[model samples]
Target: MSRKRKETEVFSLSFLDCICCGFGAVLLLFVLTASRKADQMDDLQSKIMAVIGDMEYEISLKDKEIERKKATLAVETRLAKDSGARLDETKKRRTELEDMLKLLLQQLAAIEGELGKLIDEKENMPTQEEKVPIPIPNPDRRQYLTGFDILGNQVLFLVEASGGMTADTLVDAAEWADKPEKERREAPKWKRVKKALKWMIANLKEGSNYKIIFFNKELVPLEVGFGRDWFDPMDPDLTVEVLNAIDDITPEGGANLEKAFAIVNELPIEPDRLVLICDGLPTLSDSYAGGGNQVMYDDRVAMLRAAQNALKLNLPVNTIMYPLMPDPGSAVHYWRLANSSDGSMISPSEGWPDI
Candidate 1:
């Protein structure tokens, strides 16, 4: 009983106060630490957000730059493709132009060759000496024949009536040979030839005996009765009759100079002077009867020799040559013949005779 009275109060007031104070201090410290930690967490979160935003912005800029680069590359590629296509077109065009240039050069060379041939032919032409004019009754009327001398009393005119007389060139003659007879008669070359013949007849010595023989494949006189006879140049109606007869004739055959010379040789009176009016060398001869249309140069030369031999009389031969295509040898041959025969050769201009 005495021990229980001594230890009655086990938990005192002071001890309780000390425990509460300790609990209160612990709660205050906990609140202060939690507030500080919350503030620090908020600051750290803001900094992280700022860093993420900067990184995202940097990534967006990089994407934009890459897009720009891609666009630029696309444009460059298109330009490169266009440039390549243009280069290809230019190469093709250049090749075409080169081909055209080559063709033009070839044509130019051909033309130059032809021109050179012409120049050579012209340079090799024969030269003639000037002669004194023969006195005539009416010199004013026959002024065109001032330099031309009719030396012989008995003159024979051998006119060519071949188809080549209708045109200035063989090509034209061949083209016009199939035309109507009226057209051939109206040809400019034929008309000029007739005028030349008339001029020649008008300029013959007065009272001189003359014969006009037109020959092609066959010999033809002004009239059948005049075949072997000479015509009186003093006849007033003779020129008109001859002109009328010539007007009625149409050139249609190849020339046969050998036959013409043979006919002249058979004349009743031997001619002292022979006037040959021809366009080219003979294309027809007795030896060339079975020959084709094309006459070689050698064959034509042979025919010319034959024709020359046909004339038995040693008479002067005067040649009046007209233009003929591809007959470059004709001029030289005729010139030599005229020179050898002591006669003159004339290649009249288009404006000759002035009629």
Candidate 2:
């Protein structure tokens, strides 16, 4: 009985020891699992904190944007004033430019006028410039003589289309009718006249009337236009036909000075002038049957009466004489004609020039 009781005690002690070992192993496993779970939780918390930090940064940026917008709106309220200030600056610049332009225009106009005056004075005093004299009407005379009516009432040309002149001389003469006094003086009278004519045609006023009368024996109209010679002298818009026709006048002649003068008598308006352009004394000037030897004066001089009869009740004659040689007879005729109706005479110097 004692041996059996001791055996039972030993078995009980072994069972208790086994139970303690199993419990210690389970406790150790539970501790390890709990520590792993705690580590995973800490990692999740770190991720959540990082996301929170990004969201805070975004929120701060949004706050800054709102403040910037508010500042922009505050500044925009006075847009009208800002725009007006800029506009005023622009307007001031424009005004200054306009004033400068106006001053420049005035200066240009003054210069052009001065040039015109200088051109006019050159005719009276001897100068190379072909400046025609400005004839102010003599109040004492019963005539309608006036200065270069810038209104160029007529484009009358007393051209010397005589066979004696070279083709080049005629061409040159035709082109120089409108030259300035200086240029005219620099060249021959014939060439100067041509230059002057060309100048006139190219620079005539818009409302001026013009007629180109070429004459040797009979008077011939070369170019004609109402208000403005051929085309506006100041501004030309010439037709090809007119330009060709103007350039087509050939130098041919029978030289009856009286015939050209007679053209004035047939004018609808009294007459501007009987521009007697002659390089020499008139050939066959009088009636052949009057005395057979000398030309008759009564018939030739009768033109004066006819001129006086046909002229505007009080228009004077004006003479521009071109002679190869300065003949006393031409001077006498020009002098007589000019004084006969209080006209003026323009003749070349004493030297004889080639045609």
Candidate 3:
């Protein structure tokens, strides 16, 4: 037994070497895995840092944009406030100007009133010599001269008794045209026309022979059937009759100056002067054969020119024009006619011949 124990060994060299090699291999694997993990952590940390840096830059840019918007808002607010102030100033200036205009109008009205009073005083003043005394029927009544010589031995008055004479405007005339004859005769314009005729009759020169022919589509003498006779202005009965007849007449139909002037040819004596009392130019003529209910402006003018040719005698034409709406050309034409005929054209004031 002693001899067998002496030769036996507890461990061998190959087994120890195997154990050491296994330990070395495990250590190497651990070192390699640790190095790879450390490298991956470093890369992740770098990516995280770059992301944070970019987010911080974006936030800074947003802050700068907010500041710029705030600045723009401030500038716009300032401009709006300035514009509002200027608008208020402009409104205030406009108000002041309007007030000034109103004040000026008032002053002008006052001045005009004073001027009217002065004119009235001058007209009412007594004259030393009475060459052609303009007779005032009433002492309190005011009368105005026609501003032309009305001195003629034989005077003829051609009054237009057209529908237009019933009113100042065409619309009103149309309205009145459909009214009753009595109502039409009582129209304000018609009454004024009657007053004008009465005033002229009252102011006629002493010993003068006068004839009145009222014409529309037809010619009508003051006294029917006396179209060719002249009445003495001094005959009080005839004057009253003539006035009464004029008052009774109702204005109707269109004005026919051609027919009216043709009546002059039928007169026993040629008139020394012709007084035309009308609102506007003739709307009807014998020469116009055109078939239409309405008469155009140009047609009316042509009718007037044609009517002038009907006058055989070259007597002075004194026109006393009353206002008619849309008759602008009438004034110029009448004025030219008067100028050419060495006569006067008067558009009397509303208060003239204050009956």
lDDT digits (tens) for residues 215-236 of candidate 3: 9999888772354347776665
Considering every candidate listed, which one attains the maximal TM-score? Answer: 3
Best by lDDT: 3
Q: List where candidate 1 sits over 4 angstroms from the true fold.
A: 1-147, 224-229, 288-293
TM-score for each candidate, following the candidate numbering: 0.56, 0.42, 0.58
Sort every candidate by TM-score, greatest first.
3, 1, 2
What lDDT does candidate 3 reach at residue 135? Answer: 75
- By TM-score, is 1 or 3 better? 3
Q: List the residue pairs that clash in candidate 3.
A: none
Better of 2 and 3 by TM-score: 3
Q: Model 1: per-residue lDDT, tens digit, 1-355? A: 5665566565799888999999999999999999999999999999999999999999999999999999999999999999999899677656645554564476568769999999999789787675787777744224224344465689888989899998888789988899999999998898999888876676677768887888999988876234424676556445445556778888878889999988877887888878899998888887555345677877777888889888888877888899677788888998888767667778889887564
Local distance difference test, each candidate = 0.79, 0.53, 0.81
TM-score of 1: 0.56
Better of 1 and 2 by lDDT: 1
lDDT (10s digit) by residue, model 2, range 1-355: 4565444465587899899999999999999999999999999999999999999999999999999998888788578679899889667656644554564476568779999999888657765756697775765333324422223355455565554332224456445444543444345444544543453344444665555667655666765445333334432234322444545655544455555555655656543433444554454332222344554445434433443344443444555556543234556665676677665556644342211
lDDT of 3: 0.81
